[model samples]
Target: MTEQNENGDFFLKYRNETLFNDKNSIVQCLKYFDKDNDQSLDLNEFEQLLKSLFSHNGNSYQIEMAKIKAMFDFFDSNKDGKIQLIELENFWFKIIKPTLFPKNALLIVDVQNDFITGTLSLTNCPSKHNGAEIVPIINNLIDTVPFETIAYSIDWHPADHSSFIENVNNRKLAENSPIKENIKTFDSVIYEAYPNVLQILWPAHCIQGTNGAKLHADLKQVDAKTDSLGRSVIYVYKGCLSDIDSYSAFFDNCRLNETSLHNDLKKLGITDLYICGIAADVCVAYTSMDALGLNYRVIYIQDGVRGVDSDNIKKQEINLVNNGALLIKSKDVYDMVGCKDRRPELAYATFLSLARSNKV
Candidate 1:
């Protein structure tokens, strides 16, 4: 910030209020989000930026926002239903240190209903895992972290499509065509390309207005429609492609037309990303790997994560540590955010155009 001394000498001091000790991460996180040119970073811009960091196909504007109520539960440390700079910076320091927040801090992964319900789970073909442990941990984490911004990914599908078995059934009966459902009974099984369909077939779920598509009971909305604290949250839609699956919220995994989640994160000056969710071996794994690839420090909490156990979660954790990522637990998160936030301010341009009416 620009200031003058008693001798009328002007000089520069703190430029960014979002300052942290880490040169690679926290310090970089402050480079863009300090909006007021003040000497201390606040929560206003920080929270907003975290919500809208990912935009795939620029259609994020059309995404469903009903699931973002948890964002406020994380960022509003005071439990007063409102977030100010004081409330935000305080919790941030608490997470980085330990013994800083009024309580503890945490981050959550996908807890939506479509993935948790037995009928809605992607692996519906006889699987013991139902995304239960991951759901409760996410719920509990939200309560612990103050000023925590929540990012949820919803898998939306178009009304009429070849992705669903029902849709395929309808087409078979029409136009004097008969494509049987069973293996031997089929006249001809159309070899369609669906990267999401693993070798097995399961009932279609998350078809827009369907109940299975909503957030799970354990992951219920904070206050019906709005966030529990009445704060705004950002919603991102993934796996919109009828031809493929997008397990990772960061990208579609096809790597064809990627969104700027990294850039949005950089703009918000987020140094550390904590990831957890259902299908720890799939979506959660893919997202954590991608985040580290972008040079972001990450902590993957085992308690906050669940998986189909197809690939052994333990082995996956080892892979993460090998790639500059940390495999932590729910309890460890509290120590990480216990006391490591420093509030600095950045100087930026604020143009003001004033208009006055007077009679001369």
Candidate 2:
């Protein structure tokens, strides 16, 4: 390689290392990157400073420089070539302190194929809300939303699960001579899943090892790629037992057992939860309510969920609203996070726009 190319490669490599540094405390970072004793950072020093503050994995030099320039311009109030101590302080206060991206989590509930186009498809459901539609919206959210943790719940059930009406009818037939070929969906029956527990049967769905049990092909997991900003991807499996149903991601249908979801969120120190996914009236609603019961703030993305029953969906909305769940659309999420752009002025302006929007 030529001398000029080699010089460029060295600077790029140095920049990459600084960008991915896990060092805590802005003061320590400033001292380490500041090669000179001067308290102020010149364009080169400022570039290094900003890069260290944010994560940049394998970004091209041109792109990284462009982003650095935008951020420098945002903090450089006097347009002086150097960013002084005051500017550095302002950067920390405005950009870093206000947006602690890792305190929030995105929870997606039951976006499996069974809820979409499988035998128990929500499309064939009473509301006829296409569960597949949520895949793209949620995939987009997974990319754009700056959440610390991302969690998904899948309904994985045993073949002879008690919630299945087929199982119930068979049990009844064994007791009596015969019965109707099958009961309609949503019809209740007193079947003995437990000694005295009356189980409300549902259409057989999400059996383990079945196509219906898998998450949708289009649904993008937060950490599908190494470059994904999503810190962790947690999968919570529910309704796996043959004798019980599980609607809430955190607990079984009878609240007899709890999933690892609660402990995971607690371990991550998550304070706010943003939820979306299939069957808004059932799984989504149940999970949101459970989150509320745990004293965590909850926001339900209305456009990102479909429902099995239209009337039950309306009722669930009323119940959720009454019990303190913020109902919002997908577009409002940008404002909630105050924009992922590193430019402080633009981020503040976007936040102000949402403040005036009167939707929050």
Candidate 3:
């Protein structure tokens, strides 16, 4: 039989072995699977337990023996070839619970010196919002919440970056470019290049190794390594290529190149991304949109973000909400992260993720 058929047969046989009634506690469920009544589950019994967990509401997850073996070994913490009630309890709380809920990450996007007070300061932008105002708000969240992962994205552009107004003459403008002659900052222009790109012109800022490229001094800088709380800190640098501009921390504007943010978050099993930062209409909006596209539950912290254009920020908020992102305030984050304020929208995101993986 083919592997698929074999897995299907296995599911058919075990789908009805155990029913997960709402009243059944973990201990009770373990006893139900312990057919031998030895207060422990052998590999076969453990497989049935996992099968039951994944099979629910007219869906049966395809079981892979190798994956099952690995999980079995992990939960068999003592390596006794069998999982005791205690080991099963650990599995229930640590693995199963989080799977049903979600693992969260805080993504702080491009809150740098240049955007706050240097050359490209938002105070000079259309909205004239103080970018520095978000620093303390983000810092408070960092200090209070025990997020599983925290990522900070920076605009690490090169001196001759195409998005910079000074370099507008370096590249040939596309024939279809809306504005070619007398190009000015904040004007949208199309470049004549492979996969012709449309770019917004900005003053030269965030040049590599420059002081403006540095994150704001007061912004909390968590070490880019695993901490004692098992939390991971990551720094994502975008717009490094002199040719292309990158707004989303995950991918370049043209989607030609990808930053390590996606793979890094995947490695940590990040399910939900709580995004907050500068330029809500630009980088922050792009990052949040990309996060939603990647199947993450996105929560946009409204007050924790500052934007360059107030009108565009409002439009971005509407767009994000229409695309399954939750618009929330910083005040509501604590309860949400602790899973005390379980929003149905977030739960729906979790369900959609499981459904896409064919695990529902």
Candidate achieving the largest lDDT: 3
lDDT tens digits, residue span 48-73, model 1: 33322211111111212322223334
* Candidate 2, 180-224: lDDT as tens digits: 346656665554434434455678999998988899999986663
* Candidates ranked by TM-score: 3, 2, 1
For candidate 2, the per-residue lDDT at 277 reads 91
Higher-scoring candidate on TM-score, 1 or 3: 3
RMSD (Å) of each candidate, 1 decimal: 17.3, 13.1, 11.9
lDDT of candidate 1?
0.48
Instruction: State the weakest 10-residue window (summed lDDT) of model 2.
Output: 1-10
The list of candidate 1 runs beyond 4 A from truth reads 1-107, 122-127, 159-202, 220-232, 259-264, 340-360
lDDT for model 3: 0.80
